[model samples]
Target: MLESLLWGAVAAAPLVLGAVLAGIRAWPDRLLGIVLGFGAGALIASIAFELWQDGLEQGGPVPLAIGVALGAAVYFTADRLVERWAKRAGGGAAAGVPLALGALLDGIPEQLVLGFGLADGAGVSVALVVAIFVSNLPESIGSSSDLLDGGVKRPAVLGIWSAVAALCALSTVAGWALADVASASIRTGLNGFAAGALLVMMVDSMIPEAQKRAKDLAGVATVFGFALAAGLSALGG
Candidate 1:
């Protein structure tokens, strides 16, 4: 448990870095997109090649199907609700609350997957945590900045981010605990579902953000991120 929590902290490091970066200078929207895209691509690839594959090898088709469906449903539903709330809030001070809430919720599954991976094995968990930490940094910073730009106080912004971070950590703990007692088939299903959900998130959030930054840069970053993740996966394996 201690090791898993430590790994979770490591996984969240990128998010903390990104939040700090957001305070540095005005990042071009397109550049942001590119960076996020690369990160997302890496995440998707890692999920597919590492986690999902292992799950399938462990349990077979039923687990994969159940996991995929559950993950997709959870991601899509949560996203839709958040989008609606954000849209209703519009571009005002009040918008910050919903935006922060949405971003926090969006991070839950990622944390859950991180914990699940760790519970499975140290090598796999470490690789996934590192990759995810790298990916999450920009997002945390960007989201915090967005809230600040929308007129949220700095203290409030930090508080909300901290809370969200705590929630993410909690999710990982929960996932680790649940996975410990779960059947092999259930574990496989959960991992598969997580991969599916992560893929959707990458498409919906990370890729769009990266593309909005700089198309060429985003493309390069995406490739580089995937390569880096692949290397990490190999090392871990």
Candidate 2:
């Protein structure tokens, strides 16, 4: 538990740090786009080589499929609802609620997988940790900045980001606790759930933003991120 907590903090620390950093400095959208593109690529490799492979091996197809479907549905519905609320409120997600949901949607599962991976006593995966950290920083920075621009006070923005970070960190402990009592099938299904959620997040949020901001550089950055993370995944394995 302690180990999972420590690792969880290490992975999630970026949210708080990024929020603080964004508050202090203004980032260009193009740079944020490139970073997000890089992160998307890293997460893509993670879903493919790590999450999906583990799910197929541990639980077979049925639970994995159901988990994936449920995960997609959950994230899609929640994201849409948030978007609707933003529309009603005045502007896009950035102006209304900020993009913290974007971070949380993926953050929870990554932390869960982190704890689950540790359950086998083989230690955590550096690949997953790096992917999470890289992805999280830009999202938090964008979210925090947008919130500030929307007239949300600085302290409130930090508090909101802090809350998200805390919840995401605690999910690691929850993952460890759940994994301890879960069957192989259950673990696999949960892994599939994480992968599905991540896929939606990339498609709906990360990639589009990257394209909008980074333009030609987006594809290149994504490819670079993929190659680096894939190599790390091999080494971690």
Best model per TM-score? 2
Per-residue error (Å), model 1, residue 108: 4.5
Report the lDDT tens digits of candidate 1 across residue range 1-237: 886677666665565566567666766667666666666667656776776777788788888888878877777787777677667877455433433443454456556666776788845446655666655665566566666777777677666667777777777787787776767787677677667676676666656656766676887888887888877777666
Runs off by more than 4 Å, candidate 2: 92-99, 125-128
Put down candidate 2 lDDT per residue, 51-148, tens digits, no spaces: 78878988898888887887788888888887788778776334514247756766787677677777767676666577666667767776776677
**C-alpha lDDT score of every prediction, in listed order:** 0.66, 0.77
Query: How accurate locally is residue 170 in candidate 2, as Cα lDDT from 0 to 100?
Result: 92
Off by over 4 Å in 1: 91-128
Cα error, candidate 1, residue 189 (Å): 2.3
Clashing pairs in 2: none
